[model samples]
Every structure is written in structure tokens, then in C-alpha cells.
Target: MAFAVTSSTAIRSSLSTPLEQPKAAQVGAFQPSDRHHLPPAAVNFSRRRCAVKPLNAEPKRNDSIVPSAATFFASEVVEKIDVEDYGKLAKDLGNASPLEIMDKALEKFGNDIAIAFSGAEDVALIEYASLTGRPFRVFSLDTGRLNPETYRFFDEVEKHYKIRIEYMFPDASEVQDLVRNKGLFSFYEDGHQECCRVRKVRPLRRALKGLRAWITGQRKDQSPGTRSEVPVVQVDPVFEGLDGGIGSLVKWNPVANVKGTDVWSFLRAMNVPVNWLHAKGYISIGCEPCTRAVLPGQHEREGRWWWEDAKAKECGLHKGNIKEQNSNGGVHANATVQEADLFNTNCVVNLSRPGIENLLKLKSRNEPWLVVLYAPWCRFCQGMEQSYVEVAEKLTGSGVKIAKFRADGEEKPFAQQELQLGSFPTILFFPKNSSRPVKLSI
Candidate 1:
């Protein structure tokens, strides 16, 4: 969902009114005026002295703190918590408040737990953790494409909480390889999954490697389609624990059942630091290129990956359980190249340089067709190959011709001039008797 703190009601009410201009402040500096619409707790917290110590004032490490295998390098260093025990704990806290859940989680995992602080809900988690007066960890994914405002907010959060956040980054070599092959904005041409895998998922995997349990601000209402069944606590199936031992990796979604309004209430009550972009209407902030401010009445998810269909909304970080729906009416994580090739051979018309020009000429003849312009290197394009072929097969005898073109190869120039290709794997529909083609949302 878009990452913002204001209630939908408040946002809608303010839409017709002019926004108060913000006062000039240092870049990344917090402005008092930003809290104008927030609840009374926010104002109070901002005015009073918060009970947080400066980072230089080192607190003694708790002896109960257990280290992950990577960090400790000794199997006997810490007692292993059973996964079944965690299941029972989740059951016990099933109806507990978010703060209660956080307190329990911190007690169980101690310093081994790291809060995945990214959006507004995360800051609330931080606040709750701080209220527990326990040593915990916080980390964020620095995708390198984050907004300047986000960097400023990072500083604000650190200063406010008096905590150091470990900023994880993607591997330099992998990023260099992706950019070298696809350029900086390949995600615009293709879908965001590949880019997200590189920028977010991998880095997150690295960050979790040394932790026993990790916390997230995920809630059921965030994305009903993708996150509705999110459990408060679970043994993360997608990621393994530090040493592949039992009870190594646990994931906690303390606010899993909490509503967006409740999260905002908590944040306001605690006067927690938040991203300034939230004030501008970004509810679920991610990378700058992918995130945008949402209109008052729109769902928060609409602000993210606006180009893709709802089913494709996730960026693979939380998609470990979602089954990929293939074009052949089947589900799987991946399709074999042989299956994709076979499907393409049977139903898809492969277009070359001359083939593309000829297809364009057909526009004058009032012939209509659906064409897929793709790059062989694009992972999204490759994943959709079988699905496109399935679509083609369905329309085989329906009088409409289905075709495919290699945008990065033979039809590159035509795709640029005529197709106006913006990202990898663009699909367009040429309606009969029309000179222009319409891009189709996938």
C-alpha cells in the first residue's frame, strides 16, 4: 500500500482545500508544521522531552541476547527456541494488541530480532519496541532508488528514536550487471519483479542472515489480495535461518491484524518520525521511480506498480507463497523453457524486421491484431511467454491474429517509433479501422 499516515477521511476532506505551504527547512529536517493534521499525541510528544538516549551513550548488552549462527559462529552459544513454541505463542497472542505482540516477540528474540522498518506502520513498531525498554535491531533496505526525502526521514527517525538503523544495500556486482545489461530504467520497460529481486529481495535476504527473528509492519488490510492471510508470526518458508537449524528464522508481523487507522493513531500518539513523502500523499513508499502519491479515494496499492495488474502487484519479497498463474490455466513458480518454446511455436507468430512493417501495413487494410513486443533478456517477458501463447491459442480460430515481436532485436527501431515502447514486454492492440494501437494493461 502507499505509505502515508493521514486517514482517508482527512485526506479526502483536505483535497478540496489548498495545502498549507511547508516552511523552508534543511533537507531531511523535520518541520513542526508537518504535524498540523495529526492527532494530539503527536503534538504532545513533539513538545516534550522524549526518554531516548543519544547513540554514543552505549547501553550494556543484555546477557539473554542470542546471536544467529553467522554472527556467533558457535552452535552452543545460544539455546534454540522451538518453532512449535513460537506457534503456541502466536496462538496465545492471536487476540493481543500490537504492542503486546511486540513485547512478547522482543522477549523471545531479544537482540536477535530486527524490525523491518520501511513505512509508517514500521515506525509504530519501533515505538512499541522502544516502550518495552528492550534491546532490539532495526534495518531498512536502501535500494539506491529511494527518494531524497526518504534519506532525510531516515536521519529523522534515528535522531528521534536514538537508534542506529542498519541500511542494507544490494550487492554491487549484481547491480552493476543488471544496469549494464538493461540500463537504469529497465523496470519501466519491463515489470518491477526482476528489479525488486535485485534491489530489495536479495538485500533483505542478506540482512536476515544473521538474525533469528525479524519484525515487519505488515497488516491484513494493506493489500487484501496479497497480504490478507498474513499471520502474526510464522516460520518463514521462503527464507532459511542462520544455520539451517530448527527455529533459526522466525518472522513476526506484530500489527498483522491492526487496521491502518490504528497504526496512524499509534504513530501520532508516540510522535514517531515518519517520511515527509507521507505528507505529500505517498502511502506505501518504496523506490522513487515506482512510488507516487495516490488520489484521495484510490486504494493504497494503486500507488505502487501502477502499470501492472493487481495480481502482479507484489515485488517477490512477500510473494514466496503466491502461485504463479500460467497462461495454460496451470499454476507453478516457473515454466520450463521447453514448454514456453512449444507454446510459442504452436500459437504465437514470431515477427522479424520485415514482419513488423508488414503488420503495420495491415493497419491500412483495417485488420486488427494483438502483438507482444518483448526483449529476450527480460525475465518478465520470459515468464509471460507461455501465458501469451495460451492467450493466442484461445483466439486462434476467433478471426484475430496473435503475434510476438522481439523489441530488443529486429523490431527495435519500429518499437521505438511506432510502438513507443517504454518498458520491456509491451503489449498493444491494433483495432480494425484504426491507425493507432492502444497499449493493453497486463
Candidate 2:
């Protein structure tokens, strides 16, 4: 018999108050929500209803179906799938709504399919999956550097959805090794690829080791240059798994055709818990150190690794390859140096070795200046470019010179030694006649 699943009742019935919020002590102290003061808005869900036949009620057919992992006693046999079949299926469902695509996926893969929840689009996927009244799995990559608000949103999602989210973390030893050798923020000096590989890619690989298929919230419009051809379903070329063995896995992008506005509309309409940072202009959320809110009229990708070119926006999680062409003839060989002279100028100056002497002369005049040490490849720095420029324009009359230095280029040593930089896009305030520079919080 077909069952009617009202979104409100289904969500309310499934959601019981979490016994306790998950502790994030190892990462950082992030309070999810106060027990007495949990905002109703965060948990409010849409009342829209739909009808779906439960998998158990449907007649058993020849289609290969993996039993839910929750049924531990069931057979652990892996299902063999033809790649050609999924390619055809992707084409058929290419124009389907996100919910319809999700329903088809859950029916086929059962618990073997898992949602790779990042923040926005993933949550919308979860809302649709939950409405189906079928058991499914969800996982997230807890890159050690996620914002505290992201952690809070994670908890809120769990409490509202009534599901346990498997958070995959980088191996402790691997993280320790990377941090020990390269320092806390090595991505600023060498580029973000290496750090992302250690913190995000490896952990995600481990997480997908057991799943047969995975889903993401990638949209074609998000990165037209890189993700323009994203299909609703395709074989993941990079990672492997299906029944916990090494093999190509089905990858689903149910919302690939949906716009960002549509995702936000669903979130608001469904009252799905979302990362609070979104309200502050952070469209695409990732590691705290790497992400920032974009200015008005900026693209979402700009909020991510902004220092890189448009085609290189991916962090090897989706696209799988992180290698960049070393075609520069080693011009960036001194890229690792951390000490250099700062340039002085009246207006917004791009500081470098040639201008260092002039900067010193300006320093002697006792004028306060705001200096930004940034990497050209850092996405966060790129997102803040317009705002910083505006700040400089406004401060021009106050005798305050806004200046910047490229830490990833010729002035790397200057940023490393003089700034004592820990992360990319470091900003400092030098007061008149003071030998010390106060690090300004971004």
C-alpha cells in the first residue's frame, strides 16, 4: 500500500530532541545551541506533503538492491553495476527535479548511497531524502579548519533530521605530520592544493571507502568554467567504492541544474538548518581559514580559493586532480622565502623589492598605514579585494595609506618574517612612529 508522507509530520515524528549535542572539543569549543533557547526558526520545517510507496511495500524485482547497513545480519554481497546503465539513467533524469532524482537514487541504492553534505545544497538533499520515509546515510568531511558556526549547523541538522552524520576527519598522524613540517597555514605559501589533499581529500576518500554511490550539491552555474558540464549522474573518476571494494562508484548531482537561488528558497521554505555564516554573505562554505563572504556582485567561487585561477577552483575533492603545470621556469623559486622589505606609498601600493626603499622613507614620516599581506592564489583574499579597495579609497583623506604585498610572489620572505604570518591574507595595522604592527582581525 502507498503511504502518504507529510513533510511536517514525517520530520516531526522522526526528530526527537537529541540526548546531547555532539562535542567538538577536539576541534574547538563550539556550542551548538542552548537547550532552553534553541531557535524555533532553525527547526521549523515545511508542511508540504507527498506520497511515496515504501521500499518494503513494493514488489521485489530483478533490480540489484543492497540491503540497508542498519540490517547488519543481511547479506553483505556487493552489487555489480554497468557504467553504461547509469550514463543512460543520467540522461533520462537530466531534466528531472532534484526531489524526483533523489527518489530514484534512494530506491536503487538504499543505504549504500550516501549524501556528501557540505552545507547548503546538501541540506536540501537531506530534506528530500527524509520526506521519502526511507533509511539513508549521510556523511561530511570535517576538515579540521571549519568555522565554529558550521559545527553548530551540523548539530542543528542532526537534531532536526534525526540522523547520525558520519564526520570523517583527517588521520591524526597525517595532520600532525603536515602541521609539523609545513606549519599551521602552509597553504598560503605553497598554494592550497597540498593542504586540501591532506585535510579534505584524504578524509573524504576514507569516508567513501564503504559507500556504493555518493551525492553532492554541485550546480552547473556555480563554476561555469570548471563545472559547466556537470551531469545529474556520472561515474566518479577519482575515488572508488561499491560494497567497500575498489571499483568505480556512481556519483549523483541531483541539484546540478538547480540555481543557488532555488537552493536557498528550499532552505527557507523547509526551514532546514543552514550555516549561519550564509547570512553574513558567505555563499560557499568550507574551511574557516580558507573561506570568506563575497562582496556584492561577486561570484560564489570567489569566496573559495580566490587566489587561484577560475579553472583551478576545485580542491581535488570533486575533480580529483590537484597538479598544476610547472611551466613558469621556476620564477616562483623564491616563493618560500619569508622576509623582505615592505614598500611605502601614499595610495594603495603593491609592495615589492623595488619599492621597499621608498616605503622605508614613508615609514619615517610617522604616518599610520594598513597593510595587507596576501597570496594572489588565495580565494579568500580575492573575495575581499573589492572591500579592501573601498576601505583604502575611504581612508585616503585621513593620511592612512592602504597597502598590500603578494606573499606568494617575490615578497614571500617579507610576509613570512616581518608579518610572522600564520595564514593567508594577513592584515596588519602599523601606527605612526611605532616599530610594532598590530595584527588586524579579518
Candidate 3:
């Protein structure tokens, strides 16, 4: 039977039932009767600090799809995805739906790839993978400091899924050394990076080394400053997999384009068991000491490392998101002008050359656009990124569409000729009536 967290509301309300191992039968890995006998998620939750969002009160298992269980027990050896084509593949799957992306990753890598499940909403990865009816593996980090609710939720997931989750933990010696020297809460004084490297990143590194690829639940909306450019697929720039080296590991972010609200919607609609912490305003739940509840109007990530810079909150897990500011104290894009944009934000519309032209063509449709033509590497453009995003955020309910267009590299000539782009950062206002875009002085 297909086993994924996103497919059922049959959470074992009580921890009384012994964890049952997958029962291999004549047909496949498990008997359909095995699921029918399990308990439902009727546990009484304590009142929360914040208003609790009710789970799918009805059982979703009745409608849940169960594919070939035979695919669940054993995995056949499959050819690994070619890491060299990750760039091209990324563009190809950039707009693919989350289920489509998950299916491709599971089908290509099979058991060689593992779904990285945090005790949080990432369980949706497993939910989608199981729908593909392919054999897949899963792993998670035991930071040893997670919330009690998280651990209980992990056990509940394992029990309900009828599968084992390979758990990784930080090296005992390394953890002891750090604790013995720095005491228990040094992150508050120094930073969270070092502690996270020991508890989370290192353990993850060890886990990835055993697989050819891994699937993450990362969405572009998670950490806008760091993850805004996250593609659906890519070659892992930091961690290596089974073959052991850079470019050996392929990374699949099945939900790269999915929104946070939509993820919860999927989980709820499917009747998936969610961590109890989410109801307490802990939108970005992590290790207890380092994580707190997010206040009203705050981003989910603000709960993590609240003392640190919003842009530099990554815990070394995804090194690609790490940024090093240039001497001018502005973001310095990479060598490529187009791929490297002046700023990263989900608020503004990032239009390609063709997209800009298409917007211009829609003038008769009464659509307005405030497009910024800028070079990614220009200091002035980089400096204005903050203000630009602020404007976009403020004008969200307004009719104006704030956008960015890279007016550098091969596209520079086209931008200058058609859009009247003359400077490093040119603001062009396209009104509803006229097709001609008027240049604005900013």
C-alpha cells in the first residue's frame, strides 16, 4: 500500500499500540487489513497559547489511494540522475507542480534518494512520494534538543506510515566537547552557526553521504532572503552523496514553488498529523533553546535565531544561501548577470526579457507595471533592493505591479532599445491606457 504522511488522518491518537513492523505478504509489503485495524487521531490536545487550527476532523484514509505495496518493501537499482544536467533540468522543472517534481525525483533515484523529513510540515514530501507508488527512503536529524511535541509527532508518523525513518544524531564526542567548554547556551552570546553545525548540519552531512540524492520541503517563500531563488532541482553545492564529492549529489526541492499556506492546506486536506508546536505560534519550529514563537505580523523564520541578522539566519545546511557582502555593503551577484539578480524577494515580480514585452502588450487590458531595469552586479541596484521590496510590500493591496528586469549582459541592448533603459537602474512606469512606457526619475 502507498504510505505517505500526506495521505491519511488515521493518526494513532494514543502511543499505547506497539509500533508494528511492515508485514510482508503474498501480494506485496503489507496487507490492506493492517491499516484498517489502526487507531484514529482522537488525542486530546492541551489549550494552546495561540488559537489552534483544527485538523481534518474526519478520517481521510477512506479516500486515500493505496498503490502497489510491493514497491514499498524493496527497491530496484535505478540509474542516478545526471548531475551535470542539473542546471538545464532545474529550468525545465522550475514551474512543475510539487507532485510532478516529487515523482521525478523518486522515480529517478529510487531508494538512493531519501526524503529529508523534519518533524515539521516537510512530511508533505513523503505524502507525495508515496502517491507515486515507488520505493523511497527517509531520514531525519535528531538534534537532541527538539520539542517534546516534535518527538511525539515523529513517533506518530512512523507508526502511522508503517515504515522506519533512519535517524541521524550529532557525534557524542563533538557535542560533549562543545558543551563542556561553552556551557549549555553559548549560541545566545556568540551565534547559532557553530552549535547548529554540530547538532544539525554535521549529522545531515553524514546522512547525505549514504544517498545519491535527497528531497527537501524547502519553498521559495520559506526564507525569502536566502531561498527566494531556490529551484525545483539542482546539484548540491555543499553536501556530497554516496559517490562522495561535489556534484555527486542531486537535490530536489519538490515544493520550491509552493507557498507555506498551501503546504498546510495539502496536509490538512489529506488529514496528515502535524506537530503540536505549530499551534503555539511556533511557525518555524526548531531546537527548543534557539527557537521561539513568532509574534503577530512576523515572518515564520523570525522565530529562529531572533537575535541574528534576518539575511544570515541559515544554519549551514544549505550553504548555497549564504551571502557575503562586498566592501560596498551591498549584495554582489555572482559572475553571471542574468542568473545573479540585484535582489532576492518573493514580493516583486521578476520578469525575463520576454515577460517584460508581454506585460507591455497587455496595456489595453488595463494592467499597470512599475518595472526596474537594473544590472545585478551594480552597487546602486543592490543598495536599492531593500527599498524596492518595501515598496512592493506596501503596495500589495494596491493595483500597481512592482517588478524587476535584468538589463545587463546580452539582454542590455534589447532593454535599452525597447524599454528606454539608459542607466544602471531605470524605472519605467507602464500605465493602463498607453503602450508606451514612461521613464520615471527615482
Q: Name the regions of candidate 2 deviating beyond 4 angstroms.
A: 1-84, 243-247, 320-442
Q: Which residue segments of model 3 deviate by more than 4 Å?
A: 1-71, 74-84, 322-442
Per-residue lDDT, model 3, residue 438, is 80
Ranking by lDDT: 3, 1, 2
Indicate whether candidate 2 or candidate 3 has the larger lDDT.
3
TM-score per prediction, in order, is 0.58, 0.56, 0.59
Candidate 2 lDDT, 50-79, residue by residue in tens: 222223322222112222221111112223
Ranking by TM-score: 3, 1, 2
TM-score of 2: 0.56
Candidate 3: worst 10 consecutive residues by lDDT? Answer: 1-10
Estimate the overall C-alpha local distance difference test score of candidate 1.
0.61
Model 1 scores worst on lDDT over the 10 consecutive residues at 68-77
Global lDDT of each candidate: 0.61, 0.60, 0.66
RMSD in order of candidates = 18.9, 20.5, 21.3
Best by lDDT: 3
lDDT of 1 by residue, 190-227 (tens): 77766887788767766765555788888878876557
The window of 10 residues in a row where model 2 has the poorest summed lDDT is: 25-34
